[model samples]
Target: MPQSAQLTPEELVEVAQKISELLGGKVKFAVIGGAACSLVRVASDAEYRGTSDLDLVIQPNKSYNAEVISNWLVQKHPKIIRSVEQFGVRIPAIPIYRGKDEYLVEIEIFDVEAWPNRQQYNIADTASNPMTTLTFSPDQYSGSSGDWKIPVMHPVWLLREKILSQYEREGSVKERTDISDLQIMLQVVDPKSLVLSAHNHVTALQNLMAKRPDLINKLRRAIVCYPVFGD
Candidate 1:
């Protein structure tokens, strides 16, 4: 298999740990995307699928800049030799190497204070709230390095992200994966609770519920039909 192929869950953990170590315990961020779904699977014993990259969302203050994070990686980590573009856009990323395995470590800064007006979905409104930080549950691993502390998003919030992405791109391959991930996650989390959280946070899910009323029901059927414990 080529080194550029899919990343193992073990490798994701190692990259996360190494990134934390490189930051000397100063940086704290939320883990998201497929890698996060993989981590959730490991922790919850859900179905496993691998990812090709690690996505991070660092809460930005006056001092933290997203562009500089890529430069800092180049300056600091020997394993991360250079920075690169994400999806051909100038999103900050560094090529991470874990022995024969290599993948891009994509980073984004979440600054709710200056969220672009054009991109504000109700879910984004909740997620980008400068005041609300995600809390990791006891069931999940805290991917900390040394004395550093890293927070993991709640399963509900993570699902919100997946749903938001699927909503944004209806039939993309990524949305298909997001749907699969949501099924697995729903097995462990109460859908009602997740919906309530969205409601409390003023998410677009409220509108989604009214507009496509059977969305959650369809997802529940998807999970029920899942091959892991199929009908």
Candidate 2:
């Protein structure tokens, strides 16, 4: 297997901007996974873990389908997007290369309302359940780029997603990175905010927990370990 390298923060922002432009405001989406972690870290001036790909969760409207958007992106930006591989039904993973380094941008189309009784575990579904967005100004991180208002998953919800991913992926290569991201997020997120996030997305969390009863202990440990201050 060939080793994959992580994209720099600047490159991540650049790729995201390109994708946003390519879509031409046709779909509503938000950055998730390791890429979102990097964006948050860049904005907060905190150390971030390197990731090999960018993951986006998109909610496509009736006028446009997610699959069509993925096809269109590859067709429009053949030079930048090397190839696109579809996983199962809705996910389209696009590999992009810059010099010797290559990275992936994965897009997933999900509708929580439509699939209220979906089987199988989908981290994207949980991550975007009560989706949150934040703006990223590229000029603040890298002087060469302009401001990019990117929608990003809330750090708290991301924490929940990572915890579920860690348990579900057990021995996978990405499991270690998931654990690291969880720890980083726990440090930065306020305990009160985490509590509120859990409350707001209680239904999603309940469904996830019911699917993976084993995750309960890990979730508890994560919250218990978070540092808290008292007056």
Flag regions of model 2 displaced more than 4 Å: 1-4, 77-80, 86-128, 140-146, 195-231
Over 4 Å off in model 1, which ranges?
1-3, 79-81, 87-150, 196-231
The C-alpha local distance difference test score for the whole of candidate 2 amounts to 0.60
lDDT (0-100) at residue 123 of candidate 2?
33
How far in Å is the alpha carbon of 99 misplaced in model 1?
Answer: 7.5
Worst 10 residues of 1 by lDDT: 129-138
Local distance difference test scores for all models: 0.52, 0.60
Q: Give the clash count for each candidate.
A: 0, 0
The per-residue C-alpha lDDT of model 2 at residue 121 equals 21
| Steric clash pairs (candidate 2) | none
lDDT of 1: 0.52
